[model samples]
Target: MEHYHDRRLVEQTWGSSNAYTGSNYTDYPYFPTLAKQLLPNLRCVQVVEWAPMSDNVYNDGWDLKLKTPDGDGAATAAVASSQLADTSLDCMFVYFDAVDLAGHSSGFSPQNPSYMQALENVDVHVGTVLNALYARPNYANENWLILVITDHGGIGTGHGGITYEERHIWWIGSGSAVAKQQITGPDPGTYNLLGTGIFNQSGVDQAKLKQSPVQADIAVTALHHLIYETGINPETYPFWVGLDGKSWLSQFSGVDKDMERNNIKVFPNPTTGIVTAWFENPTNDHVTATMLDVSGKVVAQHNECSSTNKITLDVSGQPKGMYVLQIKIGEQLLTRKVELK
Candidate 1:
């Protein structure tokens, strides 16, 4: 997580128009976020949300919290670097809020000298934590999946708006599992971080991991990891109406072929009713098309036939928002963002 500012506050501070779809806040027992859903299932998950403004140490869920007297990125990183050698910890979530604070005080634009300095500071702290991880005794044998991500980016001096500078952010996953090449696709959103963690814990094959994971997908993936590692199964699980994200992961243990760009075309995006998908070349292999909403719920689906190269999908009845379109031709899959207007 980046700043503690909720969606509304960010929009109110930065939005120039009436319409806004900023990230939602963490609400428990109602509209729970990823951390709220995944923590209970995981054992000994460490969490440190430093920066005095967004201190989450008081929360009962965290196994460990670093109390920094200075409340800066250096102090937080020092604590994490010293404590990461503990082999007993299964999962950890470390959030450095210093960069965000720096942006708020100075400016968020990359041209801002202070902003660049703040990022450099973050890099140094991150290096310290990485050094600790590499120095671990079980580092060679451990299947570590290191992911670096931020909740959102700032625009101008602040954030929380729908602008590309604010909403569009990047995530880095480096380890024995991550692909060496650059992973490119539509904006996956911050909610996918939880699902990525669960996917890493699961030794599932990458070929099966089709679209990016959503909040609900994290819970389903965690369930799959539990079943894969330990034979224990929960009889009555949390009742979630959204999609079962785990179904997208492959059962085997290997990466799938990357999506062939320019092979699939979607027309009349931001569509009001009907949308058309055209495949570049006719193939005998079966092609499956699945549409998922922002909440990771399947709204529509279709399987392409050899009868024609063009596939038509109707989303007139669905609500107006962003949706993910996944086209799977055999083991290969490609994703697109569809806006229903």
Candidate 2:
């Protein structure tokens, strides 16, 4: 968990966006004054916010606070990360508000010794912290997770507001726990693709997981997985959903030919030529059966049979390999796998 202080009021494209998202959403993407959300539990958790003002650091009638981008914000985060090896969670979320400021105020910003340049300065601070963590002997292959996102973009060049352009964010994960291939098909916001989906391939298991489309929900989901794995029951189950993530170990289990076959099963998998297909508790009414390659191209099909009950598929002439079998049981769509080998 990488925590920073005064995350907003920083000098980066994402600072304002992340802040706005955190402050706006009930859970995240929105947080108001006095404004912090905490859960009840047995483990000790501490809440800390940073500001130049020492007295009542969270004070303000929406007033401007002093900018102390150069101090404990970065150092505290680094120190906290080093302590992770010795502690369980001891979670920390810190923000060095300096970059956000530099991004907005600097005249030459982002390009020429400009605002972007000042933002780069924060990298120096981040480097020191990251280097220390990497050096810790206990940290290698620790399954450490990393995520970065921009909630809303700034005006002219920053983040705020609810436009798609503003809401666009980036996500990445690093660890032996991640999937080998990157996923890019699904769009943000709301949408669901049922059978059209292949599976949750990102290396998190479903029987033990749930996923929500809302970005704000990720934090709760992550903490739940982490805390639970660490032998601690978090105060909250996931605020939005369980992990849509899959376990990398699931891959080592390898591809389950029948595991993916589902209710409509085909026998003599890897059969050369004729293969038999059956529907579990099939109907007597006329049904349509289709055979397709993994790409969904219907290489074979039976339309409006005289009877809805079922039909035997003769795949003996086909080459040895894999194929998709689709059946129309009334309005319901069912699919199974067939082997030609």
Candidate 3:
């Protein structure tokens, strides 16, 4: 297990033995872009991150508290509510991958006190972070809205998805910016990022807060909002284009609540040998589907029938690993990850 963990780091940290040492994943380019989006010309955008910790040191992975101002909860509150006593900076975004880690490792059961204790510790950590914000000046002005959320709800029954339990995460807000503001709208369709958080965008007016049904777009969504809100041109950010699943951040500009995209599908993703492609209500006509191997070689091609939205493929002989499944409908094209079994 230790080797398994170390190998992952060696492979990612030092990179492959043959690698020309391309940018480390940490240099993913978006970090600086995010920093620019949040702080702009300002500095001291401190990002304190802490992962799995414990009340009992016996199981280091399960503990949720540390000796300092770090932990998923602290990071989360800093992003959601406590920007600073003066709001001297623009905004913040926090991430809590701990609970997800715990779930992945321990299955979210209270069978071990550590699981329950970790959850309790998160609550306590959140309480302290909130206390710090309220104890400081200007935070009570209610100008702030804090959004508490899990990045993505974890698997229930040892799995992950939008299942009722896995998908049902939390969202909470308290401050002057959001007072009794309730968001009611159509469900975000098909996306896996829909209902995994509870939050309040503190330090801003609730009326101006943007509502998005598709959570998959938040990376781009937040970046664009910050660009406009902070008066920064997006072209200056090299990583902005790849931050979101799609490039046109402005396309989701309006508050039309209906969120549906029935444009594409790749079935039986972990295909045992065969899989089918389907196009649903595409915005274009004359669609074509193709399967390409990892080396970018075309393995199969089909001129999909116009009337049928589906195309079947005999992928039984393809090697096991990742392959690109491309669907081209008129001018629109999308790629989905396909795994061969």
lDDT of 2 by residue, 39-64 (tens): 21212222223443223233221222
Ranking by TM-score: 1, 2, 3
Best by TM-score: 1
**TM-score of model number 1:** 0.49
lDDT for 198 (candidate 3): 18
Model 3 misplaced regions, further than 4 Å: 1-39, 44-89, 109-114, 138-143, 156-164, 172-175, 189-341
Q: 238, model 2: CA deviation in Å?
A: 9.2
lDDT score of model 2?
A: 0.41
Name the best candidate (by lDDT).
Answer: 1
Pairs that collide, model 1: 208-248, 208-250
lDDT of 1 by residue, 139-222 (tens): 888766565766567777777555667755565556664446554533444322223322132333334334543233333333
Per-residue C-alpha lDDT of model 3 across residues 262-284, encoded as one tens digit per residue: 46677898788687987763443
The model with the greater TM-score, 1 or 2, is: 1
Full-model lDDT, candidate 3? 0.45
Better of 2 and 3 by TM-score: 2
Cα error, residue 78 of model 1, in Å, equals: 1.5
| Alpha-carbon local distance difference test for all models | 0.53, 0.41, 0.45
Q: Weakest 10 consecutive residues, lDDT, candidate 1?
A: 230-239
